[model samples]
Target: MDTDTIDGQPRVVATDAALAFIDEIRKDYPDILFHQSGGCCDGSSPMCYPADDYIVGDRDVKLGEIGGVPVYISASQFEVWRHTQLIIDVVPGRGGMFSLDNGRERRFLTRSRMFDGGEACAIPLVKRG
Candidate 1:
């Protein structure tokens, strides 16, 4: 898939490995989706899901096909991910795999170092008082 950019943020593109992984995971869970939100750093990170929950403040994007599996982006953080691609690869000591920026080598992962599944995974990351 080609890369995309909107406003000043990067878009999410699926990598070869990511596509393959998505395919394997989709066999049982076809309703796959992606989501993002503000992180400790400059912006938010991409996440994978099996379904949608209509969460407010979240943006969702359709990533088309990566390894013959369908992908979706969050409706809340669509702006921040305007031009970034989600690269799939194994991270050092990170287990299975993780997502990274296509243009840069930056990787995004949950505090638990595991896939969060969906919106429920994003709640804890939200900055609290």
Candidate 2:
């Protein structure tokens, strides 16, 4: 899918792996959703949610359909990290199992690591059973 930016924040590319992961999770929990409060260059980490809980930061980033699933970013984060690209991959971890790549060359384990201002912590979502 072509990269799209909303209100400046870079949108994450939903790859086959990402879609598959979403599908797997959805099968167990139909209300699963993905949310990000940060972005690349100076943003937070990306985390999954059972429903949209986190408030939108700045721009409204739209991640193209992944396995027919939709992903979104809060409007607030979009304003600061616009045009940023996120790379998603599965990694072995305790609570936070997803990894984020801020279009930049650097990759981070948690969203807090990308943004220097916010409290650095791992945002973990419950694995769907």
Query: Which has the greatest TM-score?
Result: 2
Off by over 4 Å in 2: 1-10, 39-43, 52-63, 96-129
- lDDT for model 2: 0.45
In the range 1-129, model 1's lDDT, one tens digit per residue, is 222332322234455555555665567666655444344542444444555533423334554444543445553443343333445432323221232222223343322122224422332221222
User: Per-model C-alpha lDDT, please?
Assistant: 0.41, 0.45
Which consecutive 10 residues in model 2 have the weakest lDDT in total?
117-126
Write the residue-wise lDDT of candidate 2 on 1-129 in tens digits: 223533333345555555666666667657655566454533354566555444434444565444554456664554444334556554344323342222223332322113222211222222222
Best lDDT among the predictions, by candidate number: 2
